[model samples]
Target: MGKTYLYLLIAVAFEVFGTSCLQASQQLTRLWPSLGIVVGFGGAFFFFMQVLKELPLGITYALWSGLGIILVSISGWVVFGQKLDLAALLGIALIIAGIAVINLFSISSPH
Candidate 1:
């Protein structure tokens, strides 16, 4: 359902926020970023729980974590000046392909 995917998108956004804050936290030394970690992940789990009501765990996790990795990787590159070499780019491409396969073809994924 549309609501299910919306919840999943919110969850992924919070997770990406949490992960981005984690990098900015500097090993948890920075105060604001550390708090962001708590709030971001907290919101992530809260909304993710809402999603669990409609979707199976394995499929949800695959989509959640897959999108998270891709977004976080981009955030790291753009916000943190991190590099994505050829191998890393290839890996990310593979991740995208895997997610596409799951969403487009896997019977378990929600329509």
Candidate 2:
């Protein structure tokens, strides 16, 4: 279970990197950032597949996407100077709450 979580964390990190690179890619026009998208997403999917071996799809996807969204948003805000409005912050907070609930209470997920 700990190994599963490590895989999930790695997957999320790669996903966030991919998403960040996607923004930096500038519509796929830039060279390094565009290549980074491929490498990041590829690594993400590879590790995500490992995670899926131990966890259910629905729960895994929820956790994966939730963390990815939060990390990517932060990356955008900090690295790209993107704006995060009050509503967006509220939404992110809600996502955090949802993830907490899942980790805390959901039997389908490993505690």
Q: Which candidate achieves the best TM-score against the true structure?
A: 2
Clashing pairs in 2: none
Q: Give per-model TM-scores.
A: 0.96, 0.97
After the best TM-score superposition of candidate 1, give how far the Cα of residue 100 lies from its true spot, in angstroms: 1.0
Instruction: Itemize residue pairs with steric clashes in candidate 1.
Output: none
lDDT per residue for candidate 1 within 1-111, as digits (tens), equals: 899999999999999999999999999999999999999999999999999999999999988999999999999999999998999899989999999999899988767
Off by over 4 Å in 2: none
Clashes of 2: 0
- What overall lDDT, based on C-alpha atoms, would model 2 receive against the true structure? 0.95
TM-score for candidate 2:
0.97
Candidate 1, residue 85: Cα displacement in angstroms equals 0.7
